[model samples]
Target: MIMSHPDSIPLNQVLPIFLQVLPLKEDYEESTAVYGCICNLVLSSNSHILSFVPQLVSVFAQVAVSPVESHEVKVHIGRAFSHLISIYGHQIQPLLGNLSPAHANALAAIAP
Candidate 1:
């Protein structure tokens, strides 16, 4: 819904829902969907989603390094992460700096 009709759906409401589902251990498919939505939001150039970037970064870092997650999930996160870096590299660097060494390294390994 967000990807197809971003104007009809307010991000403030949808983002909270995404944040809640993204960290679950039992739902890689749903988490992958969320990452896809986030990647779409980033590519769409929606400035409203910018405020949620920090939280997304944290979650993306966690998911990227999770041993139980599927390789497909990591690829989705990598897409989102790459979009984030290309568009928000300056802001993202500091946030990445705040991640644990393992998390930061995982993200770096996926960087394009």
Candidate 2:
């Protein structure tokens, strides 16, 4: 059941609208607001609804490269990873292997 999580589309399908509001210089607070929504989804175990953590980790990687993503947005992603590692420390190993040094380094910092 855990492995089948990424087949879910509503999660990815919903993010672009929030992403689009950026490149055009929209409200600064919007990204954090949307991030909070995603955070709620995560804390409630909806994050576990993914096929694997790697796919969601990829989304964070994308945000790292996103020019329109604010520093706050990037921080939001980092915080989300921190939350994940707190409850699911074992899952970070594969995700760290897949991420770039910069991103992987941040994950390391979250380790207990």
Candidate 3:
């Protein structure tokens, strides 16, 4: 649905839902899927996502640095960061310093 017409998806509605759910530790698999969905949505609709970059980046950083987060989840988070950086490196560059050491390392590993 989002892929077909990314702009049509109501980010204001969906993002709040994702932000509430994605940080929970109880549903790792579901959270991973949600992260993937977010990555795809941003890739498909960069312009629309630009407005929420700070929030998205913060969530990704949190997930990437979480000590108890699953390896699979971390992989997805890394990929998401890599894609975001690839698409918006200039805008996101300054925010990199704000990330935790672990999160910065994960991003550096996958970033070009």
TM per candidate = 0.83, 0.54, 0.72
Stretches of candidate 3 off by over 4 Å are 1-8, 110-112
TM-score of 1: 0.83
What lDDT tens digits, residue by residue, belong to model 1 across residues 8-94? 987877777767766667856676676677867866767777768888788888887888877876787777788888888798989
By TM-score, the best candidate is 1
Q: Tens digit of lDDT per residue, candidate 3, span 48-84?
A: 6656777778777777666777777667667767777
lDDT of 3 at 66: 69
Q: Which candidate, 1 or 3, has the higher lDDT?
A: 1
Q: What is the lDDT of candidate 1?
A: 0.78
Q: Arrange candidates by lDDT, highest first: which order?
A: 1, 3, 2
TM-score for candidate 2, residues paired by index = 0.54
Q: Tens-digit lDDT track for model 2 on 1-112?
A: 1123434556556554534443224564566666555545565556433333565565666556666777766776777766677767887677778878876664444323
The CA-based lDDT of model 2 is what?
0.57
Q: Which residue window of length 10 is worst by lDDT in model 2?
A: 1-10
Candidate that scores best on lDDT: 1
* RMSD of each predicted structure: 1.8, 7.2, 2.8
The 10-residue segment with the lowest total lDDT in model 1:
27-36
